[model samples]
Target: MPKKLIQRFSPKPETLKAHPHLKYFGEILQNPNLWHLNRRSAAGAVAIGLFCAWMPIPFQMLLASLLAMFFCVNLPLSVALVWISNPITMPPLFYGAYRLGASILNEPIREFHFELSFHWLAHAIETIAPALLLGSFILGVISAASGYFMLRILWRINIANKWQRRNKK
Candidate 1:
């Protein structure tokens, strides 16, 4: 059931090949494993996506895509998963990460209001950088590992069920 859901939603392999904007990827995108929706590919993509989603940077999808190609994961799924950190979800997730970082480093958490000025933003970032970075790393690792194992288990259960059904017939 999970496999079927993936296949139904995953883009056709040709989608990337035909994309004019993705030309920068050049031949790297040609790797067949990047397009396949198999257990390994899907699991790797999910992991990559989860990892990239926690990154507090621009172009998260691009990063996910590059890593997916390098790791031979499902390219579309890797890119799609980064959307889990979309605008609606960004604030709480990032706050959670910051809190986690503060807890881990045993640092006092500061409460500050948002200031749009460059000086204020830079100062805030400098003060919070350590916590934010550490929290993001920890969260990313945990989520990525969880996603990989969960997908693998789901795949195994799906395959076993298929085999049982086939044998019964």
Candidate 2:
């Protein structure tokens, strides 16, 4: 079942609550619903996580966790999803967003040369910020909606199959 599967992969609530960074959220993290593995929480966490993953911000996991807390979703899963945009995958995913945004806004796609210097970073941000932000927002929304609905459908199907097996016995 999705609940069991998610629970198996999720961090324990006590561990999260004990974490120094997450402790800043205080008593809000104590809400039981935020840790539940129900369909609504799981799907909502997926949506929140996917949306935050597409964000260009520095603290996507923190953002995901905050959203999960606000929405009363499965906090661990939401936070975990932000790893989808970790260092290994970030370049391609962000570049794709930049390309899409440029296409949507009728901006010319520019080739990026990576430089370790702050000056190059600043210049590139000035040129690409608008397209990158727009594209990221679009992708985030699409992924979130897709994840929410897909999880709901898959969870329902899993339940139905289990019921069928039980009835056969």
lDDT per residue (tens digit) for residues 1-169 in model 1: 3777777887887886888898778888888888878888989999999999999999999899989988888999999999999999999999999999999999889897888899987998788878988999999999999999998998899899999999999
Deviation (Å) of 30 in candidate 1 = 1.3
100: Cα error in model 2, Å: 0.3
Inter-residue clash pairs, candidate 1 = none
* lDDT, residue 151, candidate 1: 89
> In model 2, which runs have C-alpha deviations exceeding 4 angstroms?
none
TM, every model: 0.95, 0.94
Q: Write the per-residue lDDT of candidate 2 for residues 10-70, one digit (tens) a residue.
A: 8889998999987888999899999988889999999999999999999898899889989
Candidate 2 clashing pairs? none
Reference-based lDDT, residue 89, model 1: 99
The worst-scoring run of ten residues by lDDT in candidate 2 lies at 1-10
TM-score of 1: 0.95
Candidate 2 C-alpha error for residue 58, in Å: 0.6
Cα lDDT listed for each candidate:
0.91, 0.93
